[model samples]
Target: MVFVALLGTGTAVAGQVRGPAVVPLPPQPALPQLPWLPPLPPVPSISVQALPPFDVEPLDLDLESIGDSAQEAVLQSLQALGTLRESASVSVLGSLQDGFAFRFSQQQPPRDRTEARAEALYRSARESIDRGRYENAIQELDRLIDLPGTSRVDAALYWKSYTQAKLGQRAEALTTLADLEKRFANSRWLKDAKALEVEIRQASGQAVSPDSQNDEELKLLALRGLIQSDPDRAVPMIERLLDGNSSVKVQENALFVLSQSQSARALEIIAKTARGAVNPDVQLRAIRYLGAIGGPENRQVLDEVYRGSNDAALKRAILRAFMTGGDRARLLALAKSETSPELRAQAIQQLGVLHATTELADLYRNESSAEMKKRVLQAMLVGGDADRLIELAKSEKDVELRRAAIQNLGLMAAGRTGEALKQLYSSDASADIRREVINALFVQQNAGVLVDAARAEKDPAMKKEIVAKLSLLRSKEASDYLLELLK
Candidate 1:
């Protein structure tokens, strides 16, 4: 066998014998076939699922019905809380449970006839007195005094005595005063009655007793009464009191009498004491007198004292005196040129009371001191200078000054308040400024605008601030927005 073993083991043509006949590899097991999955449909750029149509049901609500229901509910709740009381059904006992309620009760008994007559007569007497009808006043006083069970009988008697004295009925006036003293010893008009008695006796050329002079209360009472009826006689005594012979109380009382008198002599004495009294107490009372008796003469005296005295406190008093006298020109001059900051500030405030808006604005524009500028802002607010305040809110450069202006703007009812606050909030990045803006908006009771601003805000801290402000609002819209935020 020619080794032709059928190209057996190794092929003879290739090489002698291959290392070994290559053993055929066994067939691999086939993989299980996966079910075909369609390619995921190309994702649409927009939602593929059909969206619900944009629609809103128009509200055809009956406002009347809703209002009625709301009102009914409120009434029911009030009833439950005991806030709804049937006034017509309230008995006296029930009304008295709330003691003050009895005063307003409609079931109150009608006024007694005698009491009504007394009140009518009293009113007539007052009107007659006001009209200088002393005879008519005396007639009404007599009728009122005779009305039985009238509480104003003593009051009527007192006025009758006054009317009698005014008519020069000395004996009749003395008799009336004596009856008032004997019958109504605890009357509120007792002191006045006694004073009138002393006045009657003095006018009648009767020797006044030491009891009237020794009793200080009686003395002051007598002096006040005499000043009203006999100013000529009272003037000398007033001068004596101002001369420091009497107690401080007596001097003060004398100053009061002078304040009421129209006598030029009295005014001269008052001005003298106010100008240069050794006793500061007397000077102070005299200064107050000039302020109370405000006129050109008093103003002149106040001005003189203000210029000559080195007392800062007294200078302040002069400013007040000018205020009381309505001396706007003097106040304007003081506010402009006074060296004392306190006095200047005080004058500015008085000018505000006088509504010196133009002068106040001028001072605000020209003022340099921060404290003084603060005072100007206050004065402008008091004077209702809204335009000036708005101007300051926009143009002021000092931070504190601006803040003060803005704060005062909150106090005012300026037409530009909302606009000014919005502008400040948008332009000023300061947290404090923004806070003030929010507070001002809150104070103005602006809910809708505030809510819109809050919704549009982007800054986290500022947005938080806006929400904080809105949270304080009582509006339904604000409440709804807050509920949404809670989610």
Candidate 2:
């Protein structure tokens, strides 16, 4: 038992030197709170009369550890900041030792503080803001802004934008952002600055601008002007505006202008936007504009919109398309289901205007509204249904609508409705309808009217004007009337 097993005999026992050994030690003292890194700007150009004649107000908190009172943070922050002012040394020292220990400790005295240490603190503020530590960072960066020769040019501009944005000085933020983007484009803060600039531009463009001085207004004006002079440029700008910041109305205006460009991509984007488009007015406008740019390709792309949805204005847009590519049977099918009375009537009238025949007469015959039926009958005259036009002129009760039908019938029938026109020109109750009949009669045979007009003219200009009207009529009557006028 006394013979301890020398198990370590094979290895070097105690004489071998080891490389290093881990050791436990007492905790190192934490570093004391240092002065702000750089000195602040000399107290502002105030005449020094603005400040209190006495020392700073007595601290409402204890001078031991940082107080827990509501005033502690503001008190400590102010005391810490006061170090930047050399004249405030005695007052700051009193705040630290006697009334309130706003800093980390009461043991540290003002005389013992290092300005270099203060510079470090100021630098920490800038670094904090750069890292987006807004609450803690603003005060620190503000202190640093006073420091000379550190040339925190880009940092200063950035923190200005950041703090102003936090303080809701959006115009100021935008100004600072623009300056940073311009003067400090190469700085690390430039990307964020550019972002803020975009926000302001997009914001002002999309909605109301702040009633700031001339410069901010100028910036917004320049961007909006770009929208008109260069839509391609404008469109890209609006795209970037959508990135992170835009009011809803701003977004809609951007989409609206882009939609109007009629670019293919713009159309697709508009269609997609239509799904979530917040304002129904903007959405319907987009759809109607698409219809106005009508073509087979246009309609095909908008086919679902035409067939599925029931926005009245949008449906009117689709129905209006039949003005060119009319499928009367299809229109008739859609007509029964169509809810809008106005559009239904327009569709009905367009039918007569495009391809009206006596067989479709039933559609117009049963139409009760004299105003609308007159539109149908007028469409018939234009649509080559001359006999139908004459029939309406003979029987229609609304004097003006009937006169329009009769006048158009005379033109289409080429003297076949002459008797009807003569009656309208001579006896229609309405003065306008009589004038319309006179114009139509001239269209039928201008020489007689031209002679009468020239005979009735009291002024030289009137005589010349009547002859000019006859010349355009290009009738036998016009030639005779012109010959008589020359005589």
Number of the top-ranking candidate, with lDDT as the measure: 1
Candidate of highest TM-score: 1
lDDT of 1 by residue, 1-487 (tens): 0100111023356556658678899999999999999663222121101111101111112223344334223222222212112122223212222121101111112343344345456756865864668999998888778777677788788778877876789999989988988998876567657767776777689886553323544555677778879989988877875673443334566677677778888888889889864345457668866876788878888988888887664676577667666788889888888897656767887776556788887787787777777777766655566678778877788877777777666545424466777777777778776766665565554666677778877888778767766765578978888888889
Give the per-residue Cα lDDT of candidate 1 at 378.
66
lDDT score at residue 138, model 1, on the 0-100 scale: 91
lDDT string, candidate 2, 83-157, tens digits: 222233322332332232222212223421222223344446544644556667766665645554443556566
Identify the runs in model 1 with alpha carbons over 4 angstroms from their true place. 1-214, 414-419, 426-432, 443-449, 472-480
Model 2, global lDDT: 0.49
In model 1, the number of clashes is 0
User: RMSD in angstroms, all models?
Assistant: 41.2, 37.5
Worst-scoring 10-residue span by lDDT in model 1: 47-56
The global C-alpha lDDT for each of the candidates, from Candidate 1 onward, is 0.63, 0.49
* Candidate 2 local lDDT, residue 429: 56
Regions more than 4 Å wrong, model 2: 1-312, 333-341, 356-360, 381-384, 395-401, 410-436, 443-445, 448-487
